[model samples]
Target: MKTPNHFKLTALAAIFSCFVLTACNGANSSTASSTADVILTIPVEAVLTRHGEISSSYRTTATLEARGEAEVISKATGIVQHILVEEGDAVSAGQLLAQLDNERQQYSLNKEKAELNRLASELTRTKEMHERKLISSDVFEKLQWQFDAMQASVNLAELALKETEVRAPISGVISRRYAKLGQLVNQYATQSLFHIVSNQQLEAVVHLPEQQLAQARIGQNALLEFAGMLPVNAELVRISPVVDAASGTVRAVLRVANEQQLLKPGMFAQVQLQFDVKADALLLPKRALMTTDNSPTVFVVNAENKVSRKPVSLGYQSDNTVEILSGLALGDKVVIAGQSALKDDALVNVVSVKQFE
Candidate 1:
């Protein structure tokens, strides 16, 4: 028998309702899956916290200087007759550097020597005459006085002649040559014939903050950096007992050996005065620190790749690294890059990881 028309219409409506519900559920599932896949995950670079060495240090700039320097000057007045050494010549102490005109000096010396010889012969004759009772005692005494006076004059003449040769007062390399051949030089002139500097060792004076005076001590290690050169090692050789009132700093002297003569005077350098060091310290890269707040803060990544903002207490800080006193542990990954875009408990995708040795 055929079904009624109203029952057929009701069955069709029920089927239509079921189809609409199924389509809505399918759309909702697709959208939910897409949303989950698009969840924001920031890409960042991170480094694992590790135990390493950190040092408390003070940094300042200084100009290098030769520890030993000398200005060779003319001891006698004459014209420059010879130039034995030039700029950049290596010389030793007492080495002849130049020669001045000694014609006048030589003539004076010769005259004094001749007079000394004459006086010596006359004195010998007078002594023999006195011994033979032919000459009076007064004559012998007078002759002896003349001979002594002539001998003193001869000594002075010899010294004057010797001074004509300019000698290096110290062993060093000649940095400047002021006198040229045939140039007249005066003994009392303010000009220097040559400037010699010993580069076997170098020194630099740094003024550190007064607060660091106590920490600075003799025999402490220091590092010096110059532009376009590798760092050189130095030592704290001296410290000023008093602090400078005007600058509120203390003067400290650092000495470095330049056996190869690689370092020169007047070179500007960056100086690091290391006071204390911690051998095994929880170290973190300084780049990871975020100072937006009052205290230092860093974002640490957990095992699930989620970042959490942490406030860390600090200890000694060296170059590019800081000692993490608290709020961190060894092997904890800390976000170094892309931290600006991060918040607490944010999802992160560590693009790269760096390990500190």
Candidate 2:
């Protein structure tokens, strides 16, 4: 039987279509395989266990304030003549805070000064007269004694004059005021002239329970975090060596240096006392860690470009890293990213190994 030309043409077209489809499908498969075989650059870090110290910190609340503060008060009885400083004013040592009525005191001082001058001149003249035997020894001695009494009076008067001017015993800002203009202040007065606190240098006081008290000592390192303030570097300045029987807590004072005036008195503070130190322990970034069924695991990359799940023995954890006690060694490559999709013996490509600087 002879084949038709149109039939042969149609059959040829179908075969060509089949060949084209097969070639297209093969190309698609190749492209899919290439996409699946992804070469990823991952950041890695070497596991290093060095003989250094790691501290375990205990958190406690505290109050920030100057090491010392006090209220300025009049030491003598007087009527206020002038108010030298106001609230929020900064005063220095011996800086006049207020002035008292000194008219009477000034008059007394002047009288004492005149008597001292006259007595001193008489004493000089009497000594000269005695030396030359121009006067009796009793007369000269009496003149000398009178001169001593005048000198003592002058000294007392000068002290009274100084007391008229209220001065600051320390340098600080006046946070409050009680005495006003023309106010009568008495000696050993209980009223406060000005409340001054030294904020330039501050300290934080924390109360620690007896259980954690032993971990604290003088000069131990500490960290202070104040509410709405940055973390500050501090150290244990004083520890009540004995725990308070009433509260069952020990008092710890940490000195906080605030050259920038960042810390304020009565501000809430959180203190961390670091005690335990671990040496020769492997540590990893906290983000590089993952947990499985309560088992802490890390994705470690082997030399063959394969990732395997590893169980790590962790010791102490810090703000940024976790201390690993075992299951890791120095120079071991650990993956920090893409850990969620990692599996045992899964193919991987190390992007980078983060080096410690």
Candidate 3:
């Protein structure tokens, strides 16, 4: 059983080598087990599907215009004697705006009245004589005809005197005044005495693309945005039946109520014509949608922290949100971030949750 020193040393060395090898193998097995226990997961931001309101709209720009505008003109030729109203004055229909010199008209009226009275007295006398058979029938008839002619002349004279006063034809604000004191104005003059604009109701004129013709219906609600001011509500009152041949657009008119007189004509405004709206709908953040495969797609996270890729049918899409028609359910979590790196059945860790405002 005794061995040499050299052989003993060599055997001992071999045993030490085997022990080292066994230790290394055990360490390697422990590391492999730890690695197998670990599961890889992707971090992402998610939001829950919720019910909200959304609308589909067409956007355009237009200028505000007065719904009613008119140029005030004189109906009779005369010298402007009095300027009753100034620019920016509110006037009613048939309100006197100015007065003209009517001395000549008054004198003419007086002369006609005197002649009319004389003729009336003669006609009365003629009638009495005829009734008594003192005057011939032909003479009485002639006197009656003269009296009727005189009466018509007197009426004309009165109308001429009334025309000396200039009046407003419409109810509106006087935008301009052209007539001054002692200025001679006539009906045939091309210049208007005043410019009036009705501002109680305003109009917003916009041209929409021809493709939106079917959706552009009368009585649709529209929103008008102005710079440094609150948005105004308007209604679609008119839409041109024919599309413009040159621009391939349709002219649409939206009426805005300016009862407060806050808006004026020729102001630029941004217009949003809403054609469709969904009051209660399943809404999702538009950022969660992935459109790589033609149809809209979203990565939905299930209860097991696993994401399932889904194709969704979309409805009305508005700012920052879209209406989900199918392929998603309420309370389902959808990945808004890190969705690009995800696949079906991939494990995910929701880093943050966002709620739609």
Instruction: Name the top TM-score candidate.
Output: 1
**Per-model TM-score on C-alpha atoms:** 0.88, 0.68, 0.85
What C-alpha lDDT values do all the predictions have? 0.92, 0.80, 0.91
Worst 10 residues of 1 by lDDT: 33-42
The number of residue pairs in model 1 that clash at the backbone is: 0
Cα-based lDDT at residue 334, candidate 2: 80
RMSD each, Å = 3.0, 7.5, 3.7
lDDT of 3 at 42: 84
For model 3, the stretches where C-alpha displacement exceeds 4 angstroms are: 1-41
- Flag clash pairs in model 3: none
- Tens-place lDDT per residue, model 1, 129-189, is 8999998999899889999999999999999999999999999999999999889998887
**Candidate with the larger lDDT of 2 and 3:** 3
Instruction: Write down the worst ten-residue block by lDDT for model 2.
Output: 41-50
What TM-score does candidate 3 get on C-alpha atoms? 0.85
Residues 1-357, candidate 2, lDDT per residue (tens digit)?
557988999899999999999999999999888877763433344343333456777788888877768888877788988988888787888899899998888899999999999888888888998999999999988888888888899999989989888899898888888888878898875667888988788888888889987666778888887667678888888888788999999888888887787677888877788777676556677777899999999988888878889999988877777778888887677877778877888787666566441
Kindly list the per-residue Cα lDDT of model 3 for residues 208-280, writing each as its tens digit.
Answer: 9988898888999999999999999999999988889999999999999999999999999999999988899
Better of 1 and 2 by TM-score: 1
Q: What is the alpha-carbon lDDT for the whole of candidate 1?
A: 0.92
Clashing pairs in 1: none
**Clash count list over all predictions:** 0, 2, 0
